[model samples]
Target: MKVRHYILLVLVLFTGTLFAADIRFTASVSKTEVGTGEPFEITFSVNANIERFGAPAFNGFQVVSGPNQSSSMTSINGNTSMSMSLSYDLVGVKEGEYTIGPATIVAGGKTYHSNAVKIKVVKGRAVQQNTQSPSAGGNAPAVSSAPSADLSKSLFIKAVASKTNVYQGEQITVSYKLYTSVNLVDNALDKLPDFNGFWSQEIKNNSQRVDWTIENYKGVSYHVATLKQIILFPERSGNLVLDPLSMTFLVRRAVASNDIFDQMFGGGSYQDEKYKASSAPVTIHVKPLPENGKPADFQGAVGTFAIQTAVDKSSLKANEALNYTVKVTGAGNLKLLNAPKMNFPEGMEKYDPKVTDNILESEKGVTGSREYKFLLIPRKEGNYTIAPMKFSYFNPATQRYMSLSSEPYTIKVAKGDPGTNVTAFSGANEQEANLLKKDIAGIKTGAPDLYKDEEAFYGSVGYWLLILIGPLAFIGARLFRKQQAENNKDQVKLKWKNANKIAAKHLAIAGKQLQAGDKKAFYEAVYKGLYGYLSDKLNISAADLNQQNIAEQLQLRQVDAVLISRLTDTLNLCEMARYAPVTGISEQEVFDKARSIINDIETHA
Candidate 1:
C-alpha cells in the first residue's frame, strides 16, 4: 500500500512540472533594420490563455495597423498544444535608433513579460521583395506578381509656408497638402506635427469634402488637395522646427496575373494596398522686433492697426454718465492686442473699460476690430479735455514700428439741479440717502390731529387688553427661537445651506482634471459635482438619485421644464463620457454646461 501511494504522488508531481514547462511567452519582429519610411511588424506570442494584455508604447513610430490577434490549437497523438499572438504594423518617422518596450500579459494567475527589441532606421528605401502573407493582419494586397510601386514617386505630402522667416509675434500661414498620382480609396491623419514655441489657430473649412485641383510639380501633373491650414504666431525668437506630419492611405492597385486558374475562379485582379507618407520637417527663423524707435505704449502688437476715438456727447450735466469709445481696426494679432490707455481730465471718475472683440481668423491672419467703451462721470462743472489716445504696433511689411493716434475730445459740464439730488456714493449709500430724506420730509410736516376719549382710567378695557397681548407675544417669540435652534442642528438643512459651496469645490477639481487631459477623472469629477449638488439641494440620498427620480423631484420643486431637461441631459452626458470614445466636445464646453445647469437650478429650483 505504501509503494502504490508513493507512485501516485510521483505521477502528480511529474504532470505539474510538464505543464509548467509548456508555458512559453515571447516577442518577435519581422525585421530589425529598415529605412525611414519603410513599414515593419512586431508580434507577441503566448502558449496559454491570457486574461489581459498591455501593449508597449512604440515611441518614435507611427502605428499603421493595430493589435490584430490570432489563436490556434493543435493535437497530435496524446498531446495538445495551444498558441495565441498579438501583432502590430508600424512605420518609422525619422532616422534613428529606437527600442520597442516590453509587453505584459496575465495568464493562469501569473504575470509574464516579453523581451524588448532594438531597431536601426537609416535613410533610403528598404525594398520589400516578397509579398506579405494574407494572414499578416493587414489591408494590403495578398499577392502580386509585379514589384511594389515606389511610394515617393506615386504619393507624397508637401508643407508650404507663406513666410519662412518672420519677426516674433508676427503671423505666418502654413498649409499641408496631399499630392497623389494613384487611385486612393481612403486616407487619414495618423499623427499631427508639434508646433513648439508657437501659437497655432486652425482655419476650418465649411465643407467636409476637399476640393481637388490639378497641379504641376517637378515636371509631373498630380491631383492635389489642401489637407489642413493653420495660422501660426511665434512666441519666442529662435529657429523653431515644425515636426513632420504623418498620414496613412489605402491605395487601390491593379494585380497582374498569368495563371489560367486565377481567371477561372474569377479572382478579380485588383486589391487594396496600404501605404504611409509624411511631410518634411520645416524650419522657421524668427527675429526679434527692433528696440529702436519702439513706442512706450507698445503692448506686443505685431500688425497694422488704426485707432479712432469718439465721445457720445460733448456737453452734459456734471453728474451724468458719458461713453468714451475707442475703436481699433485693421489686421494682425488683433486678439492679443491690449487696449490703448487714455488720459482723462482731473476730478473725472472712470470705470474699467468694457472690451468687445469682433474678430475673425482665416489663413490670411486675424482681422476685424475691437471696441473699448469707458464710462466717465464728472464730479464738478468745468471744461474737460481727454488727450489723444495712442496705439503702437510693429508692421512686418514695413519692418518698423508704427503708431496711430486718435483725435482729442473736449467736454462741457454744468451743475445738476439741486432738486434732483445726485449722490456720488454707490450701492447702499444711495439707499440710505433716500430713506433719510423721506424721514426728514415726514418730520417737517405737522403731526395728525388727535381725538381724545372722555373716560381715562387705569382699569379701562383697552389698556388691560394691550397689557395681556404683550406677554402672549413674548411667549410666542421664545418658542420660535427654540424651534429655529433645533432646525439649525439638522444635518439635511446644513447640507442644503452649503450645497452651492460644495458643488463649486468639486467643479474646481474637475477644471484641473480637464486641464491635465485626464478624461476619465474629469468626467468622474463632473458626475460627483452634479450628484452631490442635487442630493444636498433636494435632501435626497445619493444612492436613490437617477435621471427619473431627479426629474420627479425637480418637478415637485416647481423647476422650469427647460432647466430640468438641461440638467437631465448634462447628467446623461457625464455618464456616457466616462466610457465612450473621445468626441469633438471640448473640455471648456462641458465645464460651461455644468456650471450653467447648476446656476439655473439654484435660481429656478
Candidate 2:
C-alpha cells in the first residue's frame, strides 16, 4: 500500500509541474548567417494567455524595420488561448559574431524568457551601402488623424541666409523655404528648433499667408513657399548654430487591390502613409569687423542703403516751428542701421526727434524706412543754413564703404516777436546786460496768501475723512490678497519658492556620507541630489541638462561664472571617480567642495 501511495504522489507532482510551466515563448530568425548589408527578420512568437508583454532592448545590431505586431485568439475544446507575435527586420552595420539575449517578459504573474541565439554577420558584399534602422524600443510609425497625401519623396525644406560671416551687432536674415515637386495633401510641424546666442525676431511665418511662386531650383521646376523668415543679430562673435526644423506629413499612395474583377466592381482601396524628416542644422562663422579702418559714426550697419531728407516749410516766421523730416529707406540691414545726428543752429530750441520704423523682411533681405521728424523753432529772423545729414554703411554686395548725404536746406526767417529777434540782442553783450539790470533788486520775501491756504469744502469732516480713507482701503485690500496667495501655496509652489533651501538639505546628507568614508555612496548622493535640486529649481528635465545646456541656461539667467565652473568641476570629478577608477578622491574633500559649490551656485543663481 505504501509503494502504491508513492507512485500516485510522483504522478501528481509531475502533472503539477507541467501545469505550472504552461506559458511558453519561442523566437526564430529568418537567416542565422547573412552577408553584410543584407536584411533579415527576427520574430518572437508568444504562445500563452498574456496579461502584459514588454519588448527587450536590442544591442549590437541595427533595426532596419520594426515590430509589426499580429495577435489572434482561438477556441479549442471549450478552452480559449491567445497568441501574439512581433517581427523585426535588422541589418548589420559591422561584421561580427553576436549573441542575442535571453529576452524576458512577464505573463500571468510569472516571468518567461526566450532562448539565446547566435548570429554571424559576414562582410564583403557586392554593393557598399549605409544601413537604415528604426530607433530603440521599436517605436512605430506615427499616424495622423487628418486626411492628407504623402509627400515623402516629392517635397523638402531648406534654410537660406544672407551672409554667414558678419560683425557683431550686424543683421542677418534667415529664411526657411519649402520646395515641392508634387502636390502635397497635408503637412504639419513636429518640432521647432531653439535659437541660442543671438537676438532673433520672427519676421514672417504661417500667420501671414502669401502666394506661392513657381521657381526653378537646381534646374528643376517646383512650387516654393516661404515657410518662415527671421532677422538675427549676433550679440557675440563666434560660431552660432541654428538648430534643425522637423516636420511630419501625411501622403496618399495609389496601391493596386485584388484583381481585374475587383476593380470592375469598384472595390479598389487607397491608403495614406506618413513620413517625418528633419532639416540639417546650419553653422555660421561670425567675423568681427576690423577696428583699424572703422568709422567713428559706424553704428554697426552693413549692406547698401539710401538716406533722404525733406522739409515741410523751408521759409517760415521767426517764432514759428518748422518740420524737418528725414526718411532713410533701402534694402540691407535696416534694423541695425543708425540714423544721422541732426545739427541745429544756436538759439534754436529743438525737441527730441520722433523716430518710427516701418520695416518689412523678404527673401532678398530686410527692407524698411526710418522716419525722423525734427521740430525746429528759430529764435531770430535771418537766413540760416542747416548742414546736410550723413549716413554711412558697408555695402557687402559692392565690397566697399558707401555713404549718403542729404542736400543742405536754407531757412528764411523774417523779423517777428521781440523774443524771436536776433538783432535786438546781437549787439548786447553779457556784460552790458548785467550793467542794465544792476539797479534791479533781488527777489524779496513776502507774506503767504492766507485765504488761498484755507481749505474750501461744504462739509469739511466728510471730505477729509473720505480723502484719508480711500488710499488706506486700497492698501489694505492689496495686503490681504498677497497674504492669501502665500497661505494657499501648495507643495509644488512651496518647492519652487524654497528650492535652494531643499537643495542645501540634500547636499548636507551627501556630506555626512562622505564623512563616514563612503566614497561611492557619497559621490552618487552628491551628483544626483545636486542635479535633481537644480532640475526642481530651474524647472528643467534631468534628461536635457547637459553641460552646454546648463551653461547656456545659467548664463542667460545672469548666474556668475565662478559658480558655474565650480559646479561643472564637481560633476566632472564625480564622473571620473565612477568611470576611470583612478586614484580614489578623498570623501571629506569632495564633501566640502560639494557643499561650497552648492552654496555658491544658489547664491549667484
Q: Pick the lDDT winner.
A: 1
User: Residues 1-605, candidate 2, lDDT per residue (tens digit)?
Assistant: 57679999999999899787667797888789977556677778887644345666656666644555444333322234556776776766578898777767656447888887778989845322232211111222332222234354356777888888776556788877766654345556666655555555555321212346768877866666666676776645678787877776555545568789768886666666766766777887876655555565565567667888888887877767787898888876565444456677775645556567798866555678878877677767798888898777776555456667889988898767654432233234444355457555788687743453336664688787988799999999999999988776665556656767776776776777667765555666676666777766666654455555677878988998887887777776664443222243566777788777766767676
Query: TM-score for all predictions?
Result: 0.48, 0.42
Model 1 C-alpha lDDT per residue in residues 169-250, reported as the tens digit of each score: 8999999988877766666667787575676666644332356777999997777777778788876677888778888877
Model 1 spans with C-alpha error above 4 angstroms: 1-149, 259-268, 419-605
Candidate 1 Cα deviation (angstroms), residue 265: 16
Q: Which pairs clash inside model 2?
A: 149-250, 149-251, 149-252, 150-251, 150-252
Q: Which one wins on TM-score?
A: 1
Model 1 earns a TM-score of: 0.48
